[model samples]
Target: MAAGRAEETTLARLPGYLTHVALSFVKPDLIYQGGLDLSATGLQYPYSGTVLKEAIALLKARQPQLRVLLSVGGATYHGWDRLDEAALARLVRDLGADGVDIDFEPTDPRCVPVDGRMRCADDALSIDIARRLRAALPRPHVISAAGWSVGAYGEGAFADAPPRSPWRGAMLALLRSPAAEGLDLVSIMSYDAGPSYRPDQAFRAYRAIWKGPLALGFAVLPPANGGPRATIESTAATLSAVLADPKAGAMLYALRDVPPGPPGPDNPDYRSLATLICVTLDKPGCDVPMP
Candidate 1:
């Protein structure tokens, strides 16, 4: 059997080869209820920090190689607009996460420029939050963020019309800031673009500005209005090529969207996907050498 296939069987049994994988638990709400951040509230999340600490301990004990991060802020997270740094740090410590993924999406009317000029308020917030989170959190903890594609600068999807950008200011500022030095990874959300969007091209564009470990982000499911769906094999191939540089990695948009099924190792769709990510397995076929 193929190496990933073999591991898949083992993972289904022992379920520990999953150590090679990383997962994110999002929006525990640092400011909710006066800083008593809970994940199971309003969001209807049965799996929140309410049981996360214990869960992390158990998972880590079994796998000893599993990695999990806490994602603060989602599509409509206003609390992140003016973050409470101390509260956020405390939450990170409490969860015992590998790091924090700032999922702050800048869409508030307030993010609009003062003079109707281009600007990304979220980008400014990203730099500040990343810097503070990096400093506040203990050493060796990851500080990562989900960013829009270079096309976020308003690259026109069609051939016609002048290209405009709303986030150009933020993008430029982030590239210029020394504060970005504290970030461990910058995963670019490369979706929501016309069919012309290429992962390799997007990777190159992000590399030009932010000189850090880059993780190419794509959707496992078909995009609603933009781009094409990527199959597991194609995603694996793309990730393999990107992983040529040890510092780079690949990220799927989310876990919530995956269809309900057996554990990742047992489910064919999840297993096939997990196989490509089982880098720590150190098994043949799992190591997708650069082509």
Candidate 2:
């Protein structure tokens, strides 16, 4: 669920909805708190003391089996620098979460230098944080990161093209680095691909370099250039194809955008597609049908 801080007020209302409304259709094994981007909240780094503790208590009480994770450093939290190792270790111990999700995007100005170099001093810091957290935390928790897609990363064959940008090589280097080895999953943000959004293009671009589990992240919005339904259908078809490959899975970009509303279950938005995938995937021998 891509929940906002406001939604935390109504967090209690979720379990019933999950059991009756959502689980009735799709059984979600994990629920990542849309964000804990402490940088946005004007808090200090390694937020484990008050904020993360409360988040863990609230989420764990609702569903024990549901792996609750805290997502840090989103597109907006770019100015965030290195985290103190002691503070990070404390955070990992305090939160007792299943893992953390690093979602640093390149567009964030804080990462860009006036000299045009990608300021990635924080990358090494993050990797060290993960290593310490893994050693300190009692159980082996999964660490993940959200990355931009192949077109977005501009790596492998998509290095030079209309979608290619200066940030592509830097993004690819980050993903391929040993720093990313501790990660359990790397979700690729594939929201803004052009009108001719083909999943095969993405598949071909990433298949060679990525040896780990991959998740396809996409948005439901139509293109400003005029293709709306085509974009949605293409994304769905692409995702379905990706999921057919054992190494890939589909992750809806958000949940709030696909609220249950008048458009009904057939909507191609994130929530609907997520629900559809979860239900079909959880049940084997159940026809993998999409509405």
Candidate 3:
């Protein structure tokens, strides 16, 4: 699964290896408030029917195997008690997307309610959202979540790892809960981990909790100049690790971050990374000429 934050047309521009492409976000506020905002004004990136349709159609034509999902929630929070499952279902149908991805990050300051309530801290709320989405969407649709890195839960960290926080059990609650059984993928955001850790270590931390297929999330770009991150070579190694495990998967941070040009001398890292994903995953167009 690739968290696709670029223009939908970006799908057409790249060689396709992604089994799933999650559109960056659709706002928890909209889902929780009632319905699609429709208006372009208040939203950060307003929904665009034309862009979506073109992106969906192009991807289908270019790579029939790829599944698209509307990712909801990020670093923002309004006082939405719950998501409108019916509306989400309708949107899924309208956009021809296969499913939804829950990306609620409670620890972020944005998720904190204005009233200083702990609603975002409620573990059951995340599970409830997942359950509702599973029930509302038809069968065979994908449901995934961008989960916290194991370090956030104090499970894995290196000597130089970023500041650590206790798991607080919210993320674990989602994974260990019965609701997770319906989940197709739980991508552990493995970036920003201590530099010494291997991808398998991060993968294991989540696997220990979430009883489902797991995707190790990695970053194409490092977060800061000196923090832990994967190079092109390390990324290839991680992808190989994912291939060796039956229950494992790999998720790149975003498609847009890759250089627009073909993977080559100027953009060798992106090209090599993309090639590894395409060939390793056996996606269509891998054998075709690089775009």
Query: Between 1 and 3, whose lDDT is larger?
Result: 3
lDDT of each: 0.54, 0.47, 0.62
lDDT of 1 at 55: 57
Q: Whose lDDT is higher: candidate 1's or candidate 2's?
A: 1
Q: Lowest-scoring 10 consecutive residues by lDDT in candidate 2? A: 19-28
Global CA lDDT computed for model 1:
0.54
* Residue 135, model 3, lDDT: 95
Q: Rank the candidates by lDDT, best first.
A: 3, 1, 2
Worst 10 residues of 1 by lDDT: 155-164
Instruction: Give the best candidate by TM-score.
Output: 3
**Candidate 1's TM-score:** 0.70
For candidate 2, list the clashing residue pairs, or say none. Answer: none
Per-residue lDDT tens digits for candidate 1, residues 1-291, read 112232222212324543223334344344544333564222333444445455556556656665556776766565655566666666656756577776666664232344533345465666676777778775587777777655233222221112223433344455557867777777877665556566666666566666787877756456677455566555756666666666676666654355344434323343455455555224444533211
Candidate 2 accuracy as TM-score:
0.63
